[model samples]
Target: MAHVGVVGPSSADQRELDDAESLGQGLAQRGHVVVCGGLGGVMAAVSRGAAQSGGVVVGLLPGTDRSAANPHVTVTIPTGLGELRNALLVRSCDVVVSVGGSWGTLSEVALAVRTGVPVVALRGWPLPGDPAMHAVDSVGEALRTVDALVRTDD
Candidate 1:
């Protein structure tokens, strides 16, 4: 199973939250691990979905408090790195699925691409063309792209 990181803003809109949750559920049902910043908004929603589906979720928290993680996170690692924890989250995943947009999400996507990790963006930023990155409109498309990128042997 692949380690899939889902990144978005702490203050996300309804659409982004819904999409992130559904993507998390689908990824979990498919046996992939869910990784996130381990706070609110997209991170919380995704963790809830994956946990509800009986999937393992790894929350790389930005602060030193493990209690700062969402209730659904199965594993919480308090990095205390602030925004720099984004790099740790990206590195922990085989591929990242970005739901919606934010400066923080943009940074994660950029890091993943520059480091040769594939990214599947769901209604994310308008980034420069990169072979490792692709913008998708729906969660199904994102899952398909993820399945193709994350090999079974990994």
Candidate 2:
């Protein structure tokens, strides 16, 4: 199983949050680890989902204080780089699942593409020139796409 990074806004619509949470639970149910920015919104929701599913959750925190991570985070990595930690989060993951569009989430998608990492966008950024980043409509579709990409890369 690979580490999957879930990226999105700290504050988001209820639909996106629900999708992120479902994605986390699905990923965990399959034995994959969930990774996030470690604060709130999508991060907290995904972490909570993974934790609830009895899966491991890692939070790549932007601040120096580990306590800033959401309660669902099983492992907290305090980077102290704030948003710049986005690059590290993307690089550390084998695949990235973006839940909603935010500047931070967009940056993670861009970095994942640049680094040749697979990114399954779930209603995320509409960046030009990367057809691979098209947003999947459901959690099942996203997981299928991620599974295909990981198996292909392997």
The most accurate candidate by TM-score is 1
| TM-score of model 2 (CA atoms) | 0.95
- TM values, all candidates: 0.97, 0.95
CA lDDT of every candidate: 0.93, 0.87
For model 2, which pairs clash? none
Residue 1 deviation, candidate 1, in Å? 0.6
Single out the weakest 10-residue window by summed lDDT for candidate 1: 145-154
Candidate 2 lDDT: 0.87
Lowest summed lDDT across 10 adjacent residues in model 2 is found at 125-134
The all-Cα superposition gives candidate 1 an RMSD in Å to the true structure of 1.1
